[model samples]
Target: QDVFPSKGGSGTGASATRTDPVHELTPELRRARERLLPVIESLPGPIDWAVAYGSGVIHQANAAPSSPLQSPPMTDFLLSTPSPTQFHTSNIRSNPSHYPLYARLLGGSAVAWLQDRWGAGIWYVSMVRVHDLEVKYGVISTERLKRDLEEWETLYVAGRLHKPVLPLLTPPPLLPSLHANLLSALSLSLLLLPPRFTEHTLYITIAGLSYSGDPRMSVPGAENPDKVKNIVAGPGNLRGFRRLYGGLLDRIPGVRWEDGKVAEKGWIGFNGGDGGEGEDGEGWIVQPSSPAYLADLIPSLAPRLREGIAAHYRAAPPNDFGSGRGTEAGAGAGAGAGGTRRPYGSPVYHDIAFWERVVKDPQFRTVVRQELRKIMYRPALTQSVKGLFTAGLTKSVRYSLAKIGKWWKARQARSAV
Candidate 1:
């Protein structure tokens, strides 16, 4: 009979024999794997073995119609052992020269730099550890990968990953060490604004300013205001700003702020409405008259705006600006029960609102959304599966399963004998 084994019944020997153990490896894939093998072999610790998996292991002579081969086949390495830390440390120590490349590939150096600069070194490293591995090994779904890649590309364009080695990777690292200050300023701006207006143009403007260090910070009139204006208002400036804003916002959580007086004020500020002053009351007058206000209109405001922008770029810590869960009551109390009932009215809030308006502008929105869509669905875009695994490395999972099958086959042979 062609019947399969029932639940509690032993399957025929065919079932066991049908399982295949070996996987074919292509020449290019084999070469890539070989290159990484030495790196893995040098890893210290009690690792029993290492292997490659996925398309790297599939071994195809030519690219399928669906997946064209533009570059060398990428391979993901899985080191089998009990301790992950020891393995990772050994892996890095085994090849320090390659560590920068790994950092570049995994998007960790920017994270590390931000953490160190912002006094949140521990949190930044922790985020790097979590996100880098996940991004490296295809641990996330395709949709999520698209989102992350979009954000990374934005950061790259904004000059966030200006450090060495990062540009070598296809997508490049999000928020590199050199551009942490710019990223931080952009983050602060996002925190200050509503979600809808947060666009790439605003963030890029901030990034450009930070890079130039306008000197308007400690020294008034130290730099040319025209230069700053040129950078912020030049052609394609808006697009750059949008990416910077989007990238920064992606890193923050619960970005949606409550609608109220502060939200309204923030909205007005964002909409270029002179922040609701109308020549009366103490509101954030967009077109200010005071010398300080004129100085601040760009320069003074730039520094304050940068504070919030930078905070957002750095992935605002839970306790930052009293943003943690428990601090809600305290923040509310500090704002006073009857005091305007606004969203966190810090300078960052104002900057965020301004950028949000720029992003939401119909013309700007249409262009950016189109660009983002194009980036999202680009057919030739290649992501490294090796760098995509966070929760579990694919190679490790396949290797374990293969070993189990091999062991089972040996046991079946012994029983038959």
Candidate 2:
């Protein structure tokens, strides 16, 4: 498979760019959004940008009938401002009760300090009720928002944005950044995915990045293992996912679509140096990356990656990215478990000699996985801890008990199985 195209596609083949989340709204979605108007309107301080996410948005978009047992899931907001300290300062006066007693006593600067310095780059105020609807809003500086989106440094807010998020208050200048950040996310996720995967699996992999190695997952039913899958597979969500990711999808060289789903054709790289094309000379499969492919790819991926990758590409082996040790036999043209003739090449292998040396290194994939995990794990654990405090005593206790109960049930079910 040719991971690197000779030319970059404009990312808009025949389809138009879908930049505005408003375009996705249906009557049902609109009505559902209406219910949160009070919550949105009640935000106390200035916001550079704010997005509404979580089960609340999904429920609204799906317009499922409400259940009395579940007071509509909290309308969650990931908000950004020019200055979190200033915003919180102003907001503290307007909504004093939203702050925990300690946060209030310490002041907004202290809250912001704790948020950015100790927890993830957000200070959340949960269980704030407005017009009979519960809401949880997290505030962060626009700087942190952009940094995380570009670098995946935290993968906290970026992960939430990966799923469908209703952009409520977007500044015009930030629109392009939002679009690019999402594309970068898709590109990174694609790199991490196994060569063979279904469309839904692709989204699941992306969604799962945020939760990778999260300790909460070990706590029985602390998190629904199916949460990511459900988000991607839910009504209207897959369409939303495609709309958000379609432009970037159009740019990938050999993505094959069938029955409205997409996957790599088969194998990667060329058998007999033929470039993975069939007799018809149409369609390409997902393959290992070549050095040249990686050369092109590093630049094409998120900007933060370019610096670390460029030197590796230039040196051509025996370095950080393992561009130094495998052979043509090791990197290309191998038999699969199913007895299929598969090219056994690194996803980024351009030179045969380089592949020969690099493949021997063995730590290449591990290094990449470790780097990605490090970005996600700490932030997730910090957020989990922060949630206990931000949720307040009553809400925190209730939430914890609910999680414990769910965990117990899941444990029991597993034992029964």
Error of 2 at 407 (Å): 4.6
The clash count of every prediction, one per candidate, is: 41, 30
Alpha carbon lDDT of each predicted model: 0.30, 0.58
Best by TM-score: 2
lDDT of 2 by residue, 129-193 (tens): 76777788888777888887766667678778877666555555555667766776676676665
Off by over 4 Å in 2: 1-23, 60-66, 258-295, 303-363, 405-417
Candidate 1 has an lDDT of 0.30
| Residue 343 miss distance in model 2 (angstroms) | 35
